[model samples]
Target: MFTLDDLVRLVRDELALPLPVNGAVPDFDHALNWRSVDLVRLVLAVEKHTGHRVPIAELYRRRNLRGVHDLYTATATAAGSADPGSGTRRTAAGSPAAAAGPLPGEGYEDLSLHGWFARSAARHPDALALRVAGQDLSYRALEQAVEHLAGRIAERPGGRPGRLGLLCSRTVSTYAGYLAGLRLGAAVVPLNPEFPPERNTATARAAAVDLLLCTAEDAELAERIGRETGIPHLVLPDTPGPGESADGESADAGRAPGSAPGPDDLAYIIFTSGSTGAPKGVPIKNRHVSAWLSHTVPYFEAGPGSRFSQTCDLSWDLSIWVLFVAWASGAALVVPEKAELLTPVAHINEDAITHWFSVPSSLSMARLLGELTPGALPTLRWSLFGGEPLTVDNARAWQEAAPGGVLSNVYGPTEVTCTCTTYPLPADPADWPDARLGSLPIGPVYPALEWVVIDERGRRSQEGELLVRGPQRFDGYLDPAHNTGRFARWSEDDWAPFEPGEELTDAHWYRTGDRVHTEPDGTLVYLGRVDNQVKIHGFRAEPGDIEAALRRHESVEEAVVVPCVTADGTTELAGFHLGPETDREQLLAFLEKQLPPYLVPRHLVRLPAFPMNFNGKVDRRKLSEEAFDLIARYG
Candidate 1:
């Protein structure tokens, strides 16, 4: 039904991108060089032309001339099946490239981000787009800012569909640079200011960053990264520096010539640690972001009057979703004060923020510390929690802190564009402490997405590894070897054959590493990670389960149970706790009563506060490292 030719024509016309209409495939090398944003737009156009949801990696893997044709043919064949692979890769003719099936979202489709932003800007140009430190930028002002920066960017050397690094705090100018980079068709690499110079340098070198943009406050870090990476650096401020004119424009706009990339161009790279030694960069295409925002806006019911907090740093993919998804819906983004970011009570209350998105740890700390309350923060309507599991106790406390708000547990790794599944909060809080958050019911598959659970042997199961496939799912890692190993072919077709009386809709699925089972009602319950299970003295145990149990105890404010290796090289269960009133002996007795002897923690240490990652999760790796040092110091 869907032909590659038709898809190409549709893409050429809709996004106004140049396409090879002669049926001859273009050079893969040249295509790969095209900006990630342009490639994504091209994929979105193909999705629109053919009723198929093209997976992100499928589109990205089309590196050169030969790959594109195979990709198109394969996707075209699988368009209407239960599963659909994008036409970026192909198997030999008559051999299925992926499980054959219709792509997800064969019927309903949401708008693109470009369409939504354009509409919002036209309709509510005067409305607030971002609020930071008591200062606000209206939609009109934001548009002007981006356009002004985009114009200047187009005149620069590395601004045209190349790598541009942005180092700044959570401020409007940082957001502006991001937009400016997008407008110029360059991939935006957001650097973490907190990162040591070495990590920053490593990231810059790995990503092949060519430009660095930093705010005045982060000048030192920016200078360090630039010096190490040899990338040209520019400081932010509307005003130009010495020997420059008042306008922040590059002088040679008229003399320089280059191509202006389209929506399929590369937008940004969100890097995450892979099983591989080096950090793996996930190239996010403009179309991937566009497709995500198109669907994300309506699903969350965001609007001009809505206000969502800026909780995540740009380095984290979560921030991309938090910032743009809300903006696409005309929601005002509120960046709390530097001090308030951890708690964010004053900012939320003062700004009347309607939507709050954070990991469980943030909510827990805020509620436990009495920094947030339901009666005081009545304006809050929705709380979206993700990154890690939301324990029942934390959920109940969060609910009490915002009685009118509903909690949605979102689940996804950086590989998948921020979130692929979400489950709404339960209506009644009756099951509070008893709730075993094994598989957080991370709602149904979003439009154009597919999910599967696999057992230890890779067989499909009601409960197993949570594998995902969707348009939003990212392609393989930046490292080719890592990409090949972790992201591999499941089957020749998009959708696997479904046997009658089976609970899951058979499809080609990506293994999510997490183990989970599906309820009869199709809700997914999360089990712990496959690696989370450990054998102690030939006895199988789950540290997460014990930790969950401990968290339910009234005296234990927070608990982390991890296997620690003692000086004798024997593995022992160790737990670090955060609670002043909770006594170790009493808590240990309570745990002993419920858990087996081996599962009970052999060592318990108290901490005034838990060290957390940016997402607010107790940094288990850090905790483990500290455990080693503590033992060495005290022994």
Candidate 2:
């Protein structure tokens, strides 16, 4: 199906290694000395393109580059011909050039996201809008269900613009619930069914939710939250039976009451980890999100035929981009169960996904599980990775697997709406940007958002703490106490070059606590965090909060949590405890009930007493140094 040259090119390009100047077969054993990531990428590309998998121990088993070419020729001769659509060459040049310069300002069709979806639904009434659990809902069917759910929400006593909680998994009820709340001019807060009930309870308490929406599966959880918070609940499918909630046919042909919510109106509230030992609510407005979609939709080239991979949960801010942007483009969003993420190649092929967005960890896990192959997903056109850095090997592997698709690494914080910057990689694997400080470059800034990196000296520089301000930036944290020192300001003189350094006035610039670098060409490169806060599996996490939760236990007196890299190269929480004469099993079990699954520490270290730094404070850094021994001795 593919030439050995194709195989050798992928290895040399991805591994950044020199191939034999003269045409010859590469030594499989020597080439196998390549980096773990690049080697994985080579195998992925070869297997997908040729349907040939080399042994993990032997690699391609070729003595030289010429040997690989002969093997490739022999393989092709053996197969007689390549499968249709197996080639990774350019497919008649891509769909036109992406417009450069600033994004068009007049493309937005409505003030609220729900309104835009309404227009799309009306325009393509029969187009597929959603697919969940093998059930497909057309645009017309989805619109009718939204209207019926809106009427039900209208009957509730929830006040105007109040918060409405939607507690459900990937189902028609959740989508209908979101539309219904927006129709009622209420801010919707999605409560993940997988999160600890206590965590959701605190989120609901923080948001001051007036109503809760749930499917039959989550009825008991809704009741618990409602009973705990005194908020009324409405069960979806209000009765027993399947398809009762999806509304396969129109409940009412006519539209529900008309409503016009402003651009600045609150749209949704997503909860993120709080350094203060509780989840913090981030309220994003319709305008904030609409501004983001204005740029990403065209950048991704999504439209009526685009099929988005719905991998993020509603609680995660990534959903904002995937959920609304697809609808605005009149595209169908394919929702897969959480478990499907483990074997994504199957779903990507079966669903013919055109666009993909997810954390690089998902890709790494898939590769670790051997779920990827060469020429596997030719349907993908755009593949974007965020939440964490995408390693050189991971990017190349994905690029080779989805040979026709473009790969990108995007970056942003929930505090600054969904996403703020996009770093699209060059289509040619050889042209991909080299890492800056060990991370792929996070390309150009969003057209509407302004970025400034401020150093510890409180002056703008090429690298420092990244700060973003513009239409996409949220108003502020939901809680006022969490807002201290989380903002910066710029004066008129600072905008224009007046002095070498001018004092700026107090104003509003959301401080993105991340430390980054700005290249001369205006590209941004993420260096590392200036603080202990981290993103584990795309969820904002604070070790202080994890430590606090551990200390809540009766046996624990002191705790410090540090980030630990597992053998598989995934980030995990490592909890070092001073008290609690306990084993890792007992502590993890206790923390499981209080923290989310991702927050649970994978490694537990118990100490007789906490270590102290020279300043008389618990030295977390010092504790991390001895983390391995502590775990080995006490784990």
Candidate 3:
């Protein structure tokens, strides 16, 4: 057990916090102004020194040195005689085949996107289905709202729209509107209210949207987009009362239920950033998402009592996972307020979240706020990070906070379903692999999928661009023209580029553009984007490599490297880090030793935080432009 003096020294050295003099057992909350991160560090330090694990939650509740020591002693004493099997059981990788058994919609042939929720409602009518913005809806109540909204949409001027656009945020109407679209057998297109009207109008027009749905808060904006795009818009009520219909009439009056969609029919269309400055549409079918759910529902162990966090926006594909996976497993979909996202510890505890999914950038944000303390999120059982590379530091921090939870790094592009590969770290951190570039391995592709890595010379290799083709892969882009050079066919151990006017087949592999290397264990490690590689002073350099080197410094929390072009038409690398102020000369000296001189960044800038994109990933494009401007203006 640790003594009071050990706690005082650990607090001062590890956390940089002042404590009461003479070891009077000062109240950590009042005297030291200790945050969750500080308490977690002290507890971890004590455990390391004593070689015994204490109840971190109990120590946190104590909030003082004397209480923490006493609790630690009691825990140590009890643990001395405790059964080995009674400790936290190690989590194992869930079998995809096991997860396929007994879902809510089992044996339901030709199930559409909305069919999952309908089955869940029938199976668990009273179960909590949706919780958002201080409101809760049971599965039964939400299904009724979806039915009423579908009736309202079907009766619109368009008369059962074949395509529907949802213009809303994380509101009850947004979730209801999405379901309503699926209920009407219309392809749902999510439109962001935060985006420019012109962009939303273009998206609505491109998708050939027949109707637009929005909550009262976004009525004007929706109307503007509808007018510009020549589409009709309907405003959904803020909350659908238990008994009221869309227009306060009989809930079943003039109700025209749409026919169920076939497996091949488009379920939804998501627009991603394009190289030509216009968004590219990727339309996913019901079968594609069904394939994903078949693997994830059981892998995450979601069920009636589990509460999944909805961290992604409707426009992001991860939102699809949160919505359908929860409904499919009879779990509750919980959405936190925008502000609450930055402080995840409090949100997870207050909401009693069991399954959590978000971009790794969310972890970085919490780390910036000093909120990712050990055992802070004791209620979380499954935590998944995606949308960006998961750094070892971020993963360890999150794992420490949710010690009882299974932490996974999932990887995929929107072209695939939400994700296609996941790397679940061992329950014991000591057994985790020493991954390359300090990024967690992306693990193997799903057993249902087929993938290959092709080198620059067009030969199959262990390290190269990854290509995949499987049941979950999207057929092609909405615009066939965007399909050029996006796929390839392998014949006789060689690859051929997909040509225009040729039919796309399941045998064709979608070019993922991601560079990866297969480890000896058969797991794949992401090595940054092939297109993102930069040539610095006649030497090739990957920004991820440089960023990893920068993060090696004990003072650096996060790092981003971008190539900046000066006015002289010369390119140089600019390094940005989020951490305490350090002497630029000294930091560069350290990087010089770790990396080649040419790979070292020419300019280093310290930031309070990295700017995140709409999808919560680092905004590399914006940072590149900013770096160029800064370099051009200053040098």
C-alpha root-mean-square deviation, candidate 3: 10.1
Task: Give the per-residue lDDT of model 1 (tens digit) for 115-210.
Answer: 445456777898788777567888777766666555555556544538888888766667777776765667888888876778788888888887
Q: Could you arrange the candidates by TM-score from highest to lowest?
A: 3, 1, 2
lDDT of 2 at 441: 80
Query: Over the stretch 328-414, how does candidate 2's per-residue lDDT look in tens digits?
Result: 777888898754554567667767787888877667656664555666667888888887656666777788788887888998888
- In terms of lDDT, the poorest run of 10 residues in model 3 is 91-100
Go through the candidates in order and give each one's C-alpha lDDT. 0.64, 0.70, 0.78
Off by over 4 Å in 1: 1-116, 158-161, 238-263, 273-278, 431-434, 437-440, 491-508, 628-635
Residue-level lDDT of model 3, residues 1-635, one tens digit each, is 36777777776676555675556655544433454445555655666677554444555556667776776677667667665212311222221111122354444344678887887898899989999978999998888878877777787665888888999867787888798888878899998887778888889998999888888888899888866877878877777643565566655522647587778888999998543245889999989988887887877787788888888778888988888989987889998776456456767777788888998877876675456877777777889998787888888999998898789988998898889998999988889988557588988999889988888766888888999999899999988988888899875467788889989988899998899889876799887888888998888989988988898887887888988888798998998887778888999899999998899999988864565677777778778879855444432
How many clashes does the backbone of model 1 have? 45
Clashing residue pairs in all predictions, respectively, total 45, 13, 0
Please, what is the TM-score per model? 0.74, 0.67, 0.82
Instruction: Quote the positional error of residue 113 for candidate 2 in Å.
Output: 1.2
Pick out the ten consecutive residues of candidate 1 with the lowest summed lDDT.
94-103
lDDT of 3 at 461: 86
In order of lDDT, best first, we have: 3, 2, 1
